[model samples]
Target: MDFDLTPPTEEMEKFRQEVRTWLEENIAEEMKESLDADEFTEEKYWYWREKHKELARKGWLNPTYPKEYGGGGLTGAHEAVIVQEMRRARACPNLSNRRPPETIMVWGTEEQKQKFLAPLLTAQMTCWQKLTEPSSGSDLASYQSTAVRDGDDWVLNGSNVFISGRGPGPAGGPDYLFGPMLTDPQAPRHRNLGYFAIPVRGPGVEIRSMNLIVGRDSHFVFLNDVRVPGDHLIGGDHQGWQVLSTQLEQEHGGDGGGGQALAPDQSVENLITYARQTKINGRSLGSDPLVEQSTEEAYIDSHIDKLFSKRAYWIHESGSQLAHEGGLSHLSDKVCGIRNANRVRDVMGPYGLLGIKDHLAPHGGTQEIQLRRAIALSHLAGSLNIAKVVLARRMGISRTQERAAPMRTSGAKAAH
Candidate 1:
C-alpha cells in the first residue's frame, strides 16, 4: 500500500488560496484570540454566531451538503480544503450537533427537511442531541424518555442529564434538540424507540446549567408534557433505533461521508514546547531522559490517534465499506487522550494542573483544560469499556456475525 501524501491539484490549490484569502480578510482578531478559550462569553458567543452565519451564507459552513438545503453543494475534496483553511486560521466554527440534520436528510419527509434541515444548514439554528438520560449512561437503547402520540402531536416527558450544549447565557440556549424516545415499551429493545426534534423554547421544555469540574457547558434538560408536532418525527414511529444507529455511528467517529479534517490536540504540542523551554538545574527539562521519553510517547500516541481519524475520513470519502474503523478511531482517541494527559502531567509536574486564571499557567491553561476534558470525555459519547465492546462487535469477535451499525450519508441517497 502506498503511504505517500498526494499533493492537491492545481485547481484545488487555487481554491485553497481563495479560502485562505477569504479567511484572512474576514476572521476577526478577537475571534482568533478567544479560539483557545475553554468557555465562551456572551460577546464571544455572538461573534461566533454571526461568523457562522456569514460562512453559511457563503455555503462554506456545510460545504458538502446539498445546495437545495443551503449548503455549498461541493465535493468532499472541496470540503476538505475548507476545513483545512478554517483550522489553519484557528477560526473553525463549532457548528456541531450534526445528527439532527443528517438524520432528517436521510429519513425526513420533504416538508420536514424544508422546515428543519434548511434552518440548520443555514446556521440559523443550533441543536443538541438529547440522548443520554439520568438513568441511562452509555446504554442508549435503554433510555426511559417516553413519547406518546396525541392526535397530530407527540407528548414527550422525560429528563436528560449531562447533555452537552451551550447553556442559557448571553447567547441563549440551543434552538432545537433531537433524540430517541421510548415509543413502544412492549416492543423489543432495538425496535421500541422513535426519534423526534423539538424546539428548545417550546412549552414544557426547561434547561438548567450543571456545575461540573471542568466547565459549565453541559446542561440538564427536562421535558414535561412537551408537545411536538407529529411531522417532526423522523424515520417513522418505532423505527428510531435504526435511525439513531446512523447518528451513533457518526458520533463514535464515523465520517458520515463528509470530508473530515484532522484537528490535532494542542495540549501535546504545548507540553513538548514547555519541556524544551523549562529549566531544571540549569538544564532544559526535555534533557532529562524521563521527561523526554514521556513527551515523545505522548506525541507518538496523539499522532496515531490522528492517523486513525485520517484513515476513517479516507474510507468514507472513498465510499468504501466501513466496519470497525469508526470504533477503532474513537477508542484510540479516548484511550490515548487520557494516556497523553497523564504523560503531560508527569512531564510538567504541578504546572500542568494550573487553570487559565493562574498567571503561571502554560499555554493559557489549554493544557489544563485538555487534561480535564480527557477525563470527562472518557465517559461521554461512550465509555472506554463500552467502546471496546462496540469495537469487538464490529470486528465480529463478539458474535458469529458482525453487528455493524448502518451509516447513512447525509445529502446522499438513503441507505435504508
Candidate 2:
C-alpha cells in the first residue's frame, strides 16, 4: 500500500485517520466483507451503488465543489484524504465519478445548478453526457445533433452511439442527460451551437443497447423533437463552444485532490502477481525473461501515468494556465492502457484468454475483458490524435503569446 511514495505530513496523517475511522464506523460490516470477495456478483454491484449513494450524501464524492451545488465544499487537500482512504481499503472505484456534476457546476446557471446539479451531488439523480455521435468520436465538435427553437422550448433531434449509461443499470436510471447540438447549422464552426439538459425518460427519446465484447452496457440514443425547457439551456444560446470547452476540461482535467489525483494501475500489478504464481509449460510464467521484462515495463508505465496526471491536476487546482497538460496526461493513460493490455496478453500467451469463462485462465480471464476495453478506450476520450492536437495548439498559443508581448512593449515605448 505504501508504494514508497512521499510520506504523509501531520495534517494528512490526521485526515487519513479521520477517513479511516469514518469508513469503519459508517460502512456496513457485511458490505465491507462482500467487497473483499473474489467472485464479483450482482450483490457486489448493488452494494457498490449503495456505497456511492452514501458517499454522495456525505458530500465526499464531489468534495472540492461548492456546497450550494450539493458538493462537499472541501478543498483539494480534503478530497485527497478521501481518495487515499478509498484506495487504502482496496476498493475498486466505480466509473461514475465526480465529472458529470463538476461539468454542470462549471457552466450551469444558478437556476440550472439548483434544478440539476443539486440532485446529482446528493445521489438524488444521475446524468449522462450525449457527446459522441455515431460518426463523431474524436471530432466531437462536428457532432450532428440539432436543436431548433420552438416558442419557449427547444426541439432536439439527433442520434448518439456508444453512450455509457443510457438506459438501465445497477445504479438504477439517470434522471436527465446533457446534450450538445447545432442551434444554427448555417452559422460558422464553433459559434452555432447550444447545450441542453434533456430528460432521459422524456417523450421523443429513443435508446438501444450497444453490445460490446467486454459486456459493457453502452447504448445508441435517438432524439426526435425532444422538447427542452428554456431554462434548460446551459452557457446561453450559441455559446455551446465555451460550455463544451469547460465540460471537456473537467472530463479530461483533474483538479488536484492532493495525492488522489489519478486512478491507480492495479491491473498491471495484478497481472504481475498472476504470472508469478501461474505455471505454464511446467514452469512459472514469470520465469520467462520476456514476461519479466514486459511486466517491469508495465509496472513503470503505470507509475509514470499517475505522476503525469498528478502534476496536471495540481496545475488546475492552482488556477494556473493549463498548458496541454490535461490532454497529455489523458493521452498517456489511454496509450498505456493499449500497450499494457497488449503486452500483458502477449506475455500470458493463450492462457490469458484461453479459458475465459473456465479454469486455467488468469484473473478469471479478466485480461481478455481488459483487452477488449483497451481497444475501445483507445478510440474514446478524445482519441490519441485529438489529444496530440490539443497539446500542439497549446504550443502554438505559447509562441503567439511570446510574440505579442514584444509588440506590446514596442507600442508602449512609442506612446511614451
| lDDT agreement with native, every candidate | 0.79, 0.68
What value of lDDT does candidate 1 attain over all alpha carbons?
0.79
State the lDDT of candidate 1 residue by residue for 86-121, as single tens digits: 877878465557666777777778888899988888
Off by over 4 Å in 1: 1-9, 33-38, 167-171, 256-261, 400-402, 410-416
Which pairs clash (backbone N, Cα, C closer than 3 Å) in model 1? Answer: none
**TM-score versus the correct structure, for each prediction:** 0.91, 0.83
lDDT of 2 by residue, 1-416 (tens): 34423357898788778778878777665545321123445565566666767786777776766677677777666676777677766553533444556556666767777998888777667777778898877777787799999999999999997777623443333567786899988888878888888887878887776777645457778889899888888876887866666566655533432345444666797788977987888998888898888898898887787777777666665556665666667778788889999887888777766535667767766677677778877766577776666656655753332111111001112110
Query: Which candidate has the top score in lDDT?
Result: 1
As for model 1, its CA RMSD to the true structure in angstroms is 2.7
